[model samples]
Target: MPYRHTIGSRTYRFDDLKTLLARASPLRSGDVLAGVAAATYEERVAAQFALAEVPLRAFLNEALVPYEEDEVTRLIIDMHDATAFASVSHFTVGQLRDWLLSEAADAEALQALAPGLTPEMVAAVSKLMRNQELIGVARRCEVVTRFRNTLGLRGRLATRLQPNHPTDDPRGIAASLVDGLLYGSGDAVIGINPATDNPKAVSNLLHMLDAVREQYAIPTQTCVLCHVTTALQLIEQKTPVDLTFQSIAGTEAANASFGISLSVLQEAWEATLALNRGTVGQDVMYFETGQGSALSANAHHGLDQQTCEARAYAVARRFRPLLVNSVVGFIGPEYLYDGKQIIRAALEDHFCGKVLGLPMGVDVCYTNHAEADQDDMDTLLTLLGVAGCNFIMGIPGADDIMLNYQSTSFHDALYVRQVLGLRPAPEFEAWLQQQGIFDEHGLLPASTSSQLLKQLPPALR
Candidate 1:
């Protein structure tokens, strides 16, 4: 079947639901690179108009990637809760958008609607929304989860203190970890993207982070972003694994490229839960995703990148992760192209993830070679803060020497916290106050004494 819409004197026809969605999407370099974007602005608008009339139920029938061919599509289809979708099932994509933006789509309503929604539905609705609309609907959907600390609470923002080292140096990693903590940045997790994936090296990093957490009694989780299989091995070795981390994609093929499958993720989730490591909650999985991953892996199956990105969220949703973030701009300019494109994709990823009920965060970053600067990051970070994002990456100085990208820094986290009046995770915030690093008002004191110093070892001090 075909979808068509007329504006003025012209009628634009989209060959299929997938083509209609691709055409309806806002302009992005990745879509263009994949040869899926609309040929002209008018065609794009026409597709949006046609898409607006699409019934929500249509997505249930039209599998962009056939159910027989893709496990992700199967997961999406088999796991959908029709009862949860009843509220908006009869509405067109446009009507769904209207309902989401209306006053009735409160936090409670959105949560109830999450299980019923497929990732494609949310992605379709997102295409019809502007940045502000995206922000508005997302802020209303509060998806909280926990491991060592509570995250996604209203008026609270968390940071993943990425103390990445160029050579997996324990000393260098420790210095950056202490620095991030002193700057009040590790409420989400003190995560490291290690330079080496050696099982022993990764296990050592995990133990080192555990030792620091034990020594200082920090109220947070720790993750060494390595392969799921590596974490599984570490778990068998009795390593301190607070969270099992993986970079997941939206499709089975894309996930296979990362050496993961739904079964593999299920195994990791079960293995991590067996440790009973969390003091607060058992959501121990941490996932990172990005746009264009499926296309990059040659696994997109002709779907647009944004839709593929949303499908990845379905994978994350299956696990009930402690943290699920889109490293939006880290894929470099080939996908997002420039600051404007990066900003748009970040908002879209955050919005789609939140609506589908994930504890979503963003790595607000760009490559050095990309057409973006710190100012672009500042704009995105501030906007995400305003939109009530669950967490962000907190590098040392907005630069990841190891990852070679410019992400938001520890200071950047503080700036957003100060400007937006957001606080860290409650448990971590109390710990900060207890250490005298943060005062009663949650502001850093003008003067520092040996109080905080006493909490650290001599080397860190």
Candidate 2:
């Protein structure tokens, strides 16, 4: 079913929401003031999605003048008792720029205030803020470095294969991996969350990937992205556990889903290190996260989803994961809600994680049950490509068998790189050229990749 946006017994529906977006009228100052004043938080958020950013920001600034002491003012900017900071609307674009660009800027205060605004408002604000503050905000936020420039290279983007299957069958899994690798993927990590969590099943999946990696002598890493405990179990049993996987959320309660705590993560980190797989040398954890995970687990910690996600990055940076990705909209529409929200959170998470000192990738994906589609993913991938994202999912035809959702495909990755003039991570790029899977430009068609594919074992072929 399409994700239900209804609050009560059918107060809203997919069509009604589409109508709301389609009918978004030109907004004015008084209308914004009155709407925020009278509407519930959910409705205000809906309005934020429907309204255009520049017009909404302009009118919100106008409304801020007369409604300084009102709830309406919170919509403009949640001061949150930052009393020295008067109404944000009072600051000119240049003054705001000075505050953001100046060394004395209160980054915590600025980030704290960000949750009150929509991504559109943030983007509109970005227009005035420009590169220095944008980069300053990115740095102050603590995005990890050399992520975009790993191996002393810049604009070197990356991609990974999900290689999921309905059955945890080795043959099925190998076929998917073959498809991804031949199409020029697996540069990020060939990590999989097996459909089944049985010990035998999980072990088999890991063994299969490790076998393929060794058989092909693939330089990239491999992982089974199950819960940390499962990975620990695999490691204890002497299976190949190259990376530890965990789902982290902003709040403690939400983290219960993965049964992880700071201590548990530390334990996994120590445990993985003790194995000394050293896919990247002491940086062997892979984490999956999204904006709505905290809320989905009913543990948002009283923060916005984006901020909650960033806090998860705090936990991620501790172990120094080689890959930390937000599945973006894969959790369904409840957290991200729609394409616009999904796109915004993708950019915000990438920017925030980069600042937080984590090598971050964006899974430009959405669940089939969610109110999003491939077109939305295209926009997100393009924007992330421009933003210098580290990686995106490269699944066959954008289909994830375990998660059963749509994501950027192998071809989609090629589309972005071709459009942006990006190449795969250096080692992977060299391998592709040697293998003839892709030229210096982009992925060859399957007929051409088949030239390399023919070299595989008959079963894999």
Candidate 3:
């Protein structure tokens, strides 16, 4: 239990370094690694090399826990290795998409010729790709799934109904859920991240969503995106919890910022399981992560934000979350500056999260002050549609009043389905057809569709 490790080619004495990387979930060494993020580009590159050491340790020790084998080591090296981007850089996006569409094209050919190419590498290349080209490759990829588990993300892109309000009132929250479900967005889960940590507020939100889901007979999971301990307490109170929600990070300090430890997360998972409220097998945990989380907690060790994001997924795997998303642009311009940077980061997170074996979704959002617009999100959404993203957030009118950001709207969900020939979860689609919710053309019925809205508690009306 000493604060030292003689890892590959270097000796790390916890007393000697400044990053909490040694004390985090992925590392979780007894010593708290703390340091300022590297200030210069050269310092950052060095930091990336240093960050790779722990993952390399995890990879070699076969103690990556839930992850038997992941692409973290290769991805970390690929991120720093500029040569990985060279072979694919020559062709225009149009040329690349065409080749992928052609029968002679092989995905491996890019790697075979260039060496060290990975999906994350392609995601980086996506920075230069026009939206159409990025989407084209996604549509042709076979890994996209249409219907799996309680949620359907691939065959039809799914959306979470994030109806967060300032008061956590039943009427306001109910109104948002009605808006999303009527717009065809409850395929993922009606998850809410509370503005306050009050257990009563969270309990009211969960029970309220349960009432709404039952009324419409919508076959989807529901969650209150509070801390693990809050959720555990709700479960202790015998409240219905379909999925346990938590926000996680790559480093121990970042997780500590959220007041969660690996043991706390495991306890939450076990307690939720004992309740047996999930309809989606055993994968009942819901987790949210963003690229800037580590840096925000002052825990990043000068590593690239995307690599830190992937390390968070290592925490996610421990609980087998039913839903996992990189809140993408929601972290704003600091970690990823502007729309172009945000777009590339979104794709990179999705690619890396999927490769790490987690169900991946992007928040596709931005704050008012960030240099991003709806068009940028539309582009990311289109590309994610093809990449086979698992689920996306569906806020009322693409805005979160409580969180103060612009996210995808329910109409956006309908837009992706219409443009891409996608469908919802099989059972949910069956239910939709049963209720005539969407026609063969995937269009909602005319008017505000008061039928579903009328089902809300009468006091709201």
Candidate 4:
């Protein structure tokens, strides 16, 4: 039997609760109350309430009475939108006191409602409720300190392990490290390749997902951009995948064809949506084109900035409602460092603040050879940040060609710390010195090796 949980005399089954909450319109009080009452277990109640579209604290405030302080605190912390709770009138002192002092309230009931709630949780919720931004200086200091320790060759080599292939055992090692580095620091997002050619890769990704779900409990989604074969395979298998879509290669011929035919883009969009609907609850992500590495290459292939943006806008305009409000993903220029303008044009013209009518996220490719240089990384980071991208994606190893020959271990760690605001360890100094990046003067190099950078495509250079 599935684990169950209860809240306010209502019991629910876990799976049922998940399905109910996953529904698009989950805020109706009658629906919630009925689901809660029909629930057969406590976890069901918890999941239903936990995954509700409305904030958990707000729901609890409106639905329950004779509340426990600790339960209210936990609900606030568990709420995805704790910011919404402050305006809720039920949390006022009078209401709280009334709920606390009411004869219907029992000490045991309060304890059960918010089991193991801590003072720290209460303080977090309280601060969030008050609309106070937590001081970010301490967090920044932590990242810098960590970076200082990881500045040496020994540190670099420690992270240079290459997995033979994407499989459960090897991928778990990667996922654990990545998850540890990224948890709670919202600067980076992970994407898994669900290519049909390699079932092991998909299996490995599932293993990674399990680890992520079990350990960090992150709520972020994944997007699969693959060919038709992989898309159909995943759909046929009835996998509860998140988003699946196609990857279009950018050549002059394809670009011209795309320009001439709205039907082509429309058909692709309709087909993806149809697949998604058939797959139960998965979403579809659209990409404008793949790999615009050279000006001449793009021009020769009919995929200049104008054409690229035009195609993106065509798709964005057609599916504005779905693309704008939905969780969508787009890839930026791959194999082309100078393609930032193309990226910017696409965003400004089709994606930026309008076509999607929502915050559109652009995924940055790790193909730039200068990824190791702090200056280069910083420039890209600043560009993406300014471009209003929601997240960045890259592989985890240096040897991965897909990552543009970048060292995944060092660069990935550094990028996460710099952009995501994760806390650093004081002992990281000893760790970095062990890696030998520091000279006798304790100063690290300002840039990566030119030889390494030379290996990158000229467009990326």
Candidate 5:
């Protein structure tokens, strides 16, 4: 049945739950490109007005993507914690929003409420929220995961030391890795986006990272972002794999386009676990998601991009991933046209992921073609800091040479840490102190007297 709302003499109707969601979403070029956006501003407001009245229970009853057609939908439906949801079962989407921002929805309550919520419900409430509302609610939702180090603890922000090399050169990667570590980054993980998927190349890069990690005893995880199948093959070959990495999407079909399924992910998760790599904790999966992946793959099944992005979190939560980051602006101008859009999407993605009980992070980034720059990144980085985001990318200088996009850098991480008084993961923080990179207060030591630079090998320097 269609849902309708009225303003004066005008009545707006949404054909279905999916249509309602699409029309309710904050305007984005991707939604417009999908031809699912509200035709007019008035219609968008009407949709939001109508959506606010939707009963939270209605999402449970109505399937946005048919149950028979999508495994992701099945996973979401079958795994929902109805008992946890009973607290807010009677509330409308708008009421839920009010409750979320209310003093009653503290950290403990939000944590307990996570498993009960569905991606659709979370996405719907998000559509009704302003950016600050998104941040405030997300701040209260603390999601901690462990793998070599604890993450998502309040008063801390982690950094993924992304030492991506265009040619998979070990020395070049090592230089960048050392640079990031010296800057007090890499507490989250030392993840690499390799230029080649060649099993040999992937194995070599993993070994290089492992060698350095072992040599320095860096208290963090490392990942070579390759296909799950390649990771499985490497695992079978006894290659050192710290975190099994994959780029996931919201829909089963979109994941299928990436040659992955829920089963494949389970296989990879199990394979990585059997290695017993982590010393601090066993949570050992890393996932990267973005707003427009499903739509870009032509497998969105008519849902809006942000909702699709939230659905990917459903998948991430299943495996209990240590790190689930949205590469927010990496998809380019088509999905997020400018800095403002990218910032909004980043906040939304973080808020949605945290609400669903995932340790969420953002790759504060943009392609060169997009209408964004470092100033935009500075704004987003500072906001996410205040929002209590789990982590951000630490590229060499807020630029990924291999991927050819701008992301948060090692220096950028320091800037945020200094300004916001955020620290790295506890384990990595101790390591920084031990290495004389950071003083007792977790601030970097003076460059002249710093031992961190001296620790770097002559070749790396």
Candidate 6:
């Protein structure tokens, strides 16, 4: 049947189920909707069964053939809402078509038409489709899952234990936090530092990876991108840079030059993969731009949300066909410096959803406090949840400090967890104590204590 395929606000038409399934099957499962399709047909069916509480296997056996399109659409919608097909892999376009055709062709004559089509058999076929979907979804999911696994409630709490005072060892600080948050969690930690205008800084950042690996006791990788001339110098030196590019945010090279725009970011990323040459190391890269709301305000020109998103898409489109890795991330949503309302609106309006599309990661800079009122926090968080933000950065402190001292940063993180429903780490309480955030006397800081009282569950203020 002819149908329209929709991803967010964009839509495309397919001539038939075969055409639709083929296009949809391989379109990277970057968002929740695609993630569902990444699961096996049997698993998808099982998910539906779990939700609908109907014997899907029996229904398939009886209604495989001659099922109405409306009925199928309803079933698919129900399954989409109820199941977390994030990890499933096996279902495919061909399998879905075959299953539907098989079911619809002969309902009551199940035994005679396809006597061997047992639940296990169906599940196996679906698994094949899911595997294909995983080829696309895995990278996107990896980027988000890494952050989620690392920053469980316990991880957030533990950040307080570190010396609040700034240190010369930013990488060390990041590594330590990763180690604590992801302890007993076995995943690679990759860091990309774009903090220098010198090519040598890229080499310096690479050397720092060793420190992060040794200190954290986990595998690690780092990449550095120097501005245009510096990047060209590094390439001449054969420094094995992961990504080298023209700085798109403030330079004349990026202006009026598509080659220096997001396209260059993609080229640099592609170059990084070539440098790897099939090694088993993670690919890490970063793009440098100006600081504060300047980027957001002039995204297309100066690095605002729209321009950042466009660049990200360009990079994703280029790399997706090659590596299928999740090492790319966008930096600098400097909340402490940017206006609160502007940052919040940008995040909700475009950034989160845009990142999801490219299947990459976002690293928003945040203050060490919360500055907004409880009501505002609630509204912001609710909006973020709807926008599908996977990672957030900010200070770990009481609600009041976050609101008053660092309102933008504070509300951003709180909303990330409280409103968005991202799960906290299992050992979050211990981490909280180490930070001196919560005391034995139950004498919480007044700002935090007051907000806590206001947000208490109906039964236990």
Q: Per-residue lDDT tens digits of candidate 2, residues 1-461?
A: 11124444534322222123212212212223223121355543443333322233343333311334322223223422233334454554335445556675454655454433333233333434333344446445423222212321346678878888877667777888888898898888887877777777888778878877777667678877777888778788999887788887655567766687767888888888898865434567788888767656655433335544655665666677878898888776656657776776677677656544467788998877677788988987887777677788889989887677888898898899889888887777877777778887777666766644666734465
lDDT of 1: 0.92
For every model shown, what is its TM-score relative to the native structure?
0.98, 0.71, 0.73, 0.38, 0.98, 0.38
- Tens-place lDDT per residue, model 1, 159-257, is 999999999988889889888888888999999998989999999888889889888899999999999999999999999999999999988999999
Error of 5 at 46 (Å): 0.5
TM-score for predicted model 1 compared with the true structure = 0.98
TM-score, cand. 6: 0.38
Which 10-residue window of candidate 4 scores lowest in summed lDDT?
137-146
For 1-461, candidate 6 gives per-residue lDDT tens digits of: 34453444744554432222223322211212212132443333333322222222332333221235322222322333113222122333234334433434232332222222222222222223332222222212222222212321212210111211122144443443343333211121232324445556665554454344444333222334346455555655766554343333222223324235444555555555556522333233433232222233332221122222232323333333211121111222232222353233334222322222222222332232323344544454344334443333233332212112222233344445444344333323333333333343222353443322343322221
Name the better of 4 and 5 by TM-score: 5
* Candidate 2 vs 5: which has more TM-score: 5
Please, what is the whole-model Cα lDDT of each candidate in the order they appear? 0.92, 0.63, 0.63, 0.31, 0.92, 0.32
What digit string (tens of lDDT, one per residue) describes model 5 on residues 1-461?
Answer: 69999999999999898999999999999999999999999999999999999999999899888999999999999999999999999999999999999999999999999999999999999999999999999999999989898998999999999998889888789889888887888988999998999999999888888878887888898999999999999999999999999999989999999999999999999999999988878999999999999999999999999999999999999999999999999999899999999999999999999999999999999998999999999999999999999999998988788999899988888888888898888888888888878875665555733565656644465
Per-residue lDDT value at 197 in model 3: 82
| Per-residue accuracy of model 4 over 1-461 as CA lDDT, tens digit each | 13244567965444332233322111212223223222334443455343332332433333111124222223223432434333332343224323434453342333332222222222112212111111111011111101112211111111212222333244444543343232211112234443244544564454454354334333333333344445455555654344444433223234343342333444545555664432212224434333232122333222222222222322333332122211111222232333333233223332222211222333332333321233344444444333333333333433343323332343553555455432222233232333333232332453421322233322222
Clash list (residue pairs), candidate 3: 18-34, 18-35, 19-33, 19-34, 20-33, 20-34, 24-252, 146-155
> How do the candidates rank by TM-score, highest first?
1, 5, 3, 2, 4, 6
How far residue 193's Cα lies from its native spot in candidate 4, in Å, is: 2.9
Provide the global lDDT of candidate 3 against the true structure: 0.63
- Is 1 or 3 the stronger prediction by TM-score? 1
Evaluate model 6: give its lDDT: 0.32
